[model samples]
Target: MSAYDAVLARQSWSKLTQEAPTREELLPLVAAAGRVADHSSLQPWRLIELRGDDRLRLGAAIAEANGDLKPSSKPLRASLLIAVVVSFRPSEKVPRWEQEAVASGVAHVLSLLLDEAGWGVIWRTGGHTRTAAVAAAHGLTENEELLGWLYVGGKPDGKRPGRRKPVDAESLLTRLPSAEGIAG
Candidate 1:
């Protein structure tokens, strides 16, 4: 699909089916996402892709950490889950927000790629974004944020609903000066 068309067609797909992509298929998608322009080559993001039993472990960990926040065992298992982590290391030159933005951009591109591959994908983040328990399980740095998890699988057959929404031109675009334009 065309770049604009892929983005326009993309939607946050929460409900997924039984089929999922292989690791080989996902590697290219991850590479596509990493191509996002990060300030310098910091490459501040890391994705921990979980499938099968690993997803089950994550579901259990999430349930234990959240206590009663999520539903029961079956629904949480999912066909595949990807943890988008912001592995931040404080830098004198770069802002923390920018690092986080790079990571978020990676996740966004991956979502688009998944949609292009005809797989349902969703990004989910919560208070656990900065939680120690969640970070520990994935061996993330102490300062990292559990930005969100992407759930991926196939689209079910039947009536498909379009998610096109009215775009307000003014509300969508913000006229702002570049950092270089601002005084240091």
Candidate 2:
């Protein structure tokens, strides 16, 4: 499929099966994601593929982090879960926030590719995102952050439509003082 088609057709798939992305497949996906707009080539992030026992450890961490909710409830559902991590290395040229944005951009593109490849993808983040134990499990230092959990699996034969609305072009664009600006 074309790149545009992949971008447009990509959807957040939550209800997925046990089949997941293989290590070989994931390497290419991560490479594509690393091609995102990272300012100054800081390369300020990393990703950890969590599966099998790692997923169990993550689920336990989640359950411990959240008292009321059962972490085991939905943690091990996927055959592979990629933990999208953002690292801050004290850059004078790039702000820490922007580095985080680059990581998110990579995650977005990776999700799109996974969807196009027939694997259901879900980007998840919660209280565990900011927890110290979870952060340490993935070797994220104090300046680093856990952006999200990218869950991958086989798409169910029948799935619900994604929650999306058509973009209001007029509301999204304005006549900025630029040569390519679209007048209001």
Choose the strongest candidate by lDDT: 2
- The lDDT values for all models are 0.79, 0.83
List the candidate 1 regions with Cα displacement exceeding 4 Å: 68-77, 159-164, 174-184
What local lDDT score does residue 107 receive in model 2, on the 0 to 100 scale? 88
* Pairs clashing within candidate 1: none
State candidate 1's TM-score.
0.85
Question: What is the C-alpha RMSD, rounded to one decimal, of candidate 1?
Answer: 4.1
TM-scores vs. true structure, each candidate: 0.85, 0.88
Worst 10-residue lDDT window for candidate 2 reads 66-75
Instruction: Give me the displacement of residue 46 in model 2, in angstroms.
Output: 0.7
Candidate 2, residues 1-184: lDDT per residue as tens digits?
Answer: 9998887777777788899888998888789879999899888889899988898888777777666455665668788899988887778899989999998998899898888878888899887789876776777887789997998899888776367677698989966677556455
Worst 10 residues of 1 by lDDT: 69-78
